[model samples]
Structure formats: structure tokens, C-alpha cells
Target: MIDCTRAMETNDAPATIAVPQDDALRALLAAIVDCSDDAIVSKTLDGVITSWNRGAEALFGYAAAEAVGQHIYLIIPDDHRAEEDEVLARLRRGERIDHFETVRQTKDGRRIPISLTVSPVRNAAGRIIGASKVARDITERQQSEALRARLAAIVDFSDDAIVSKTLDGVITSWNRGAERLFGYTAAEAVGRHIFLIIPADRRAEEIEVLARLGRGERIEHFDTIRQAKNGHHVAVSLTVSPIKDSRGHIIGASKVARDITERKRAEETLRRAHEELEERVRERTAELSRMNASLRQEIAERLRVEAERTQLLTRLVLAQEEERRRIARDLHDQLGQQLTALRLTLEMLNAQSADQTDVRVQIETLQELARQLDQDVAFRVGELRPVDFEERGLRAVLTDYVRKWSKHSGIPVRLHATPSTGERFTSEVETMLYRLAQEALNNIVKHARAECADVVLERSPEYLSLIVEDNGIGFDLSSVGSIGGGVGLLGMRERAALVGADLQIESTPGRGTTVIVRVPAHAAATRIP
Candidate 1:
């Protein structure tokens, strides 16, 4: 409602009006134009700029003195010059334009977005003289609109359900994500109670959430179950935030629901697997413990049996020695005396028959037979038990035994005795070693067909060793059990064990055979009496 003629001061105005009335009207029009925040200007119908206000100077970067009397097209960009012609044409027809938004150039050639309101200007007779234009800047409004459009696009395309509801728990807005998640269209969901998607038993949750939202509290990632349109339960994680109005008052809430059904199922599977693994571990541990206990019992039983066997072997050896001593005593005391008396009787009979030649020859033959019987008895006694072992030490016994064996068997025998071989040991150790050596020589005579043999008795700081070696036709050691000396070897090993000695046999075909008996010094010293 501005006076266009007074604002522009038209040169064609009449000079007959009262000066005070004109001055007051002109002052009022100037005040209205100066006080407006939008740019206000008046232009002649021919597109000439007639007047400009302070607002126009600020908006278009021009002062009143610089913009007045200039062409209105001076502020119209080259591409939009036809817009000014159209406005002028409309004004010539006495028309007004309301809120015509367009781009206009400033004095510095910067383009500004503005909404223009143009009206035809006239004098008191109502004849059109010029046009008045109002331009308002709308840059901030355009940016806000673009931002809103982008946010709407994101909400519509999100995978998670995004919904907005009033503080009363009634849904106000539903996006595409919400429609897909709940199996409902936006039209069906909007205006409905938000609890429609909650399970019947859990509907009370909505009341609680609404109360919190009213207090402007945000609930983040609240895991819960809900009902789908198909009436099935769905696991979801909900993040609900309070929606505020321009005055900062809580009016509603925005909820984001993410589907977590698969996640829950996977977690349950893992938990079950862990439980099963723990159960298996417990069962296996119990089984192993039982097995370990059984093994301990078995080991104890084996040790007991071994101890009993050692005692039995010791008693058997003692009985054997006693039997040998009894046999030797019988052969020496009874058989030797009888043989001596028989030899003496044969000699006296030969003396009594000296005059009878035939009788003398028969008597001499009887005497010769008696002498052979006595020698046989002595040999048998020596073989039964070598009492020499008790009287003379190991070295003397071995030397006499080996020399007699070599003479009887027609084989060369070499005997090697260490200096300590003369030292006395327990009867059991000496007997065991002597038996082993005897068995070895018997094997060489029966199987080896050897030309020469060696028997060695050596003593070390820790052990006493007896070695019997023969240069004979050897046999495969691997086939010892199947070969000729199986029983003999077993007997040797048994005797060695009784004395706590280690016996080893080494042989190869056509090479030689060697038998070694190694008795620890302490074991030999501690043999049972």
C-alpha cells in the first residue's frame, strides 16, 4: 500500500496541491520504503529505474544515487532480460504479479535467488505511469528444501525399519523400510497404534517406551521380540530417539528396528556346541582317570609276581647245590672206598697165583679193570660238584676245568684270568658263572666243531665278566631258538639272572660265537647265602 508517484516524484504531477499535505504524504511514503527489509523500487513503464530504497542498495549492491535514472534491465541477467519485458508488458495492461521467483544479478554481477512482487503504478486519475517491484532473497529456504528431500530419500530406501509415532503411541509416519519389515503398506500402518507390531504378551513395552520418549529419553539398541504381519515372532534391535518440535518440546519418537532373527539362531547354535564340547571333555577326563588307575594296579601286580619268582629261583638254586654236594659226598666216601678195596683184593689174588701163569694173567686182567673203575668214579665226582670252587677261588677252578675239558674233547682251549679273578665271591655268583661257561663249552663241542676256544674271566671296577668264545662254524643269532643251542642258551640266561648278571650271545654264520656274562660287583657281593 505504498504511494508510487510520491515515492518516485514524477515530473508530470500537477503543481496546484497544498504544500503541507504533499510534504506529509511524501514523508510517510519515504518512511515506509526505508523501513522494509525487502528491496523496493519504482520503474517507468518504459523500463527505466525511477527510485530506489536503502533495502535495494543492500540487496542489489547499489545506492539510490547510483541506481536511480538507470534502465531496470541493469540488474536483470542477460539470460533473464526477457523477464523484465514480460513484467513491463503485464504492467502496461494494468496487471500485478505475485511472488514471481527468478534469478536476478547484483551490481557486482553475482546472481541471487529472489521472489519478486510487481504492481502497475498510477497517478490520481488512475492512468498507469510506472511499475513498483519488491524482491525478497530465498537462498536459505531453497537449501533447507534440498536437505529435506535428501533425508526423505534415505528414509524411504533404508533396509532397517524407520518409523515415527506420536507420544500417545500412535504411528504418524512409516517409511518403505517399515513397510517391508512389518509386511504392511504405509497407508495401513500410519494412523495405527505402534503396538500393533508388538507381540500380544509384550504390548506393555510400547507404554513404557512412550513414557520414556515423553521424558525426552532415548533408548538405544533395545533387543526384544515383536510380531510380524504373518503373526510370527521376529527378533529385533530397536533404537528409539525422541523427536522434538521447533520449540524444543518432545512430541513423538523415531524408532529404528533391525532384524536379528538369524543372529539369535546362530548364537544359540554356538552355545549348544560349547556345552556339548564341555560335556565330552568331562566324560573323556573321567574315562582317562579310570584307565590310569587300572594301569597302576596292573603294574603293582606285575611287581609282586616278579618278587615271588626271584625268591623261587633262589630256593631252587640252593636245593640244586645241596643235591650236588650229597651226590659228590656219596661218590667220594662210599664208592671210592669200595673201589679201593676191590683193587687191593685183585692185587693180592695176583700175588697168590704167581706160580700159575694162566691164573696170573686172569688176575692181572681183573686188577686192570678195577683201576679203570676207580678213575671213572673220581671223574664222576668232579663233574657232579667241583668242591675245588670252595677250596680254591674261581681262577683255579676254571683253569683245571678248562684243561680237563680240552684234553677230553681234543680241542685247544685258552684261558685268560684277570688279577682279581682269584678274589672270592659269593657261592651263588661263582656257581652261576661256572655253569654258564660249562654250557657254552658243551655247545661248542656239540655244534661249533671248533678247533680252538677261549674262556676269559675279567673283573672291572663295577662288574665281573665271564666270556667264552670259540672259533667254530657259527650260526645265525636271529635263529637262536630254532638252532642247536636254544635250550643251552636259555639255561645260561636263567643262571645269569639268578646271580643278577647280564648274558649276551653274539654269533654270525661261519664267523664265530661269543657268550658273555656280566655280573655287577655289588650284585655278586650281595648274593643270597
Candidate 2:
């Protein structure tokens, strides 16, 4: 180094004996400059390139041959030409420019950031001749500095408390947010231990945090309690990360704390409210369950009562039928015999008084009266339920019944009956059909002022339909319910329901009335075609 510096300072030219040593020293210095990554060049006071190294060629995208003997302005951008001129003027005055940062263009006209260190170059006379320049690309350094400044600004202005701490638990940096959150200035907090904000009960937690940070672990959203400077406790969500030095070694910890006290209180209140709601729901469910049980019991009781009533009604109807049979039997046996005897007695009297014309005529009149009386008694017996109904089935009983009803009511009846197949439905079903037929005939006699009625009994594979149509002074069906329901409609409906049959009544004023009863095959039809 001394020999190179002495060569640059010498006033005289090198002697022949010293040429080998000087060339060796020159080659060594050239090798050093070529090996550098920065651009190294020497220029005259007028900005002309005097020397160019390989480092300069690589940095500006130019070879030594292309750059040598060229003006230094080849690499100086247009905007910085004035700056370069100033540099040259400063070099003329023997001034050195150290680390002067600026922009410079490349061989491809690309602009880059550079930091230049210019020193005065002198000849052997020790007189300043020109300047030697070393320029380093500082793009990465500038970018890193800008990023750091932006991050610092963000931390300082953030609402969260951001702080850095040493591995030994000492606070190294505290932002404004920490001051606002803890009620202490950054100056008062930076030099203190981390425990200044950590509650005494949480010191162990802090120790664990520091230990984890030393292991290069990041802690995120750690919920814990921290103390404020005013002696109040605050709930916080903390995010802690390890701060590493340039050598990638863990040096400290960075913590970001967010105040979550209000959130915590809200969550607790919601939990309590939810618990209270669940309790209410449980109570209401219990109440509903009890109510359901009571309702079920009530329904069961009603069903039982209805069943009893139904049984009683069935027995009453059966009893009434039995009584009718008894009365009918008594009338047929007693009154019929008496009337027959009375007729026989009148005939004997008439035969004996044959010679007296008036006496014979009077006896014959009494005979006729006895005959009519006997017929009336027979009719009354027939009006009661048919004794052969169970044995003969519904069709036989209904045929006989409709005939008697027509005669008693003095109305002509058209009975279109299906031939029976000698099959029988249940006793209840037969009784229901017989009674319904009986009731329809009775109603027609009472209300219908017409001359004739139709009783149609139809049998099909699917149904047994009985229709009783009357040419009567039919009443309005809409008024049937409101006008006292005097047509025995309710009774007919009940009887039909007992056999699971459908009963429909159609009537209009001044028209005919039709009573239809349809028994489904599955309901009561004992035979299928």
C-alpha cells in the first residue's frame, strides 16, 4: 500500500531497474479494484475518464474498451450532470466527497441509486491532478430504510399497544399507544421492566412469554389480564413475536396488545343471558309436558263416557224393540182371537135369524165391524219390528216393512228391490237398515201430502244402495236444521253411522224428497258378486 501511494505521489518517472516492482504493485492494485463489486474509476478535473476497472464495466453494463477514454458524463444522468460538474470543481480544489448519495444512469439508460466516495488523485509531484471515484448501488439499503420508517410510523400511530422488550425482560421501546393504554409516557416505560404493566399474578406468564420468544416462537391472540398504571385491571389480547438481529439471532421480543375488556364483559353478559333463557325454556317445556298429560287424561275420560253412553243407548233401543215385540205378540194373540170369536158369534146369530130380515142385516153389520177390527190389529202388529228380521236378513225385513208402511200411510209405493242371495249382515247392521227404512216411511206419511213414493234397493259388486224417493210436499233442506229438524233426519243419520253407511237427503220445496243410504262393500255387505 505504501509503495502504491508513493508511486502516485512521485514527481519523477520510474527508472528501468524499478519497472518490475512497479508493474507488480500496479497489477496487485488493479486486481483489487477489478475484484470489487462497486464501480471504481478515475477521471480528470474536466470529467474525462482517465482509467476504468472491470467493476465499472460490470456496474454500467459496458466493457473496459468501450468505457475507457470516454467522458464521465456517459454514466452521469442528465439531471445529475450539474452535480457531477460540482464534484469535479470540488476535486480541483483538492476537496474529497465522501458517501455522496445520488442517481446515476447505466449503459442501457437505466437509472439506479448510488453512493459515491470521491477522493483527490495526485501525481508524483504531490499536486492534485484528478479524482478517484467509488460508487456503490444502494437500492436495497434505501428500500429497507423506507420500509422501516413506514413500519415505525404505523406502530406509533396504531391504536394497539406495540412494544419491544429485551430478552432480560427490560422494555426497550414503547409506542404512543402504550402510553395511552397504560397511562404512562414512553420515556417512563421504555427503561422499565415488562412487569410494570404485567400484574404481579401474571409475572409467571411473562416469563413464559419471554422463554417462548427466545425459542423463536410467535404467540398470537393470547388472552390475559394486564394492569394499567392507574392500578386498574384490563383484559387484553396479546400477539408477541421474536425480534431478530441482522445475524438472524433472537435478540428481543415485540408485543402488540389490544384492549378487550369491553368485549370480555359483553361475552360474560351474553353467557348469563343465554343461561337464563335456557332455564326459562326448560321450565316452559316442563309446564307444557304437564299440560299435555292432563289433556290426554281428559280426552281418555271423555272417550270412556262416550262409550258408556253409546252402550246405554244401544241397550235402550234394544229394550224398546223388545217391548214392541212383546206388545205386538200380545195384540196378535189376544185381540186377534177375541175379534175372530166375535165374528164367529155374529155369523151364528145371523144364521139363526134368517127368517127376520132386519135382524140378519144388523148381525151382518156387526160381522163386518169385527172383520175390520181384526185387520187393524194385524196391521198394528206388523207396524212393530219384524220378528223374522234376524232370520230373514235386511232385504226380506225391509220388503215386508215398506209394504206395511205404504198401506198404513195410505200412500202407493213403488219398491224396486234387489233379489237376496241368502247372505246376512251383522244384527246391528240389519237393525240399522230396517229402522232407517221404517223412519223414512214414517216421515213420508207425516210430511208428504203426495200420492206415491219409490223405494229402490239396488245391489252392486261394490255397494248396496237404498233410495226412498217420495213425490211429496218436500221441505227446503237449508231450513231443515233451523226449522226444528222435525223430519227425523238426525235419527236417520245416527242409524246410518252405526253401520258405517252414507245417508244423503235431498229435498226442495214443492219437489220430491229422496233418502239415499249407501253401504260400502267393506262396511256391511256380507256377500260379494
lDDT to native, each model: 0.83, 0.80
Q: Write the per-residue lDDT of candidate 1 for residues 56-106, one digit (tens) a residue.
A: 999999999999999988899999988888888988887778788999999
Among these predictions, the greatest TM-score belongs to 2
Candidate 1 least-lDDT 10 residues: 10-19
Output the worst ten-in-a-row residue range by lDDT, candidate 2: 10-19
> Which ranges in model 2 have alpha carbons more than 4 Å from their true place?
1-21, 214-216, 298-529
TM values, all candidates = 0.51, 0.56
Which model scores highest in lDDT? 1
Total colliding residue pairs, candidate 1: 0
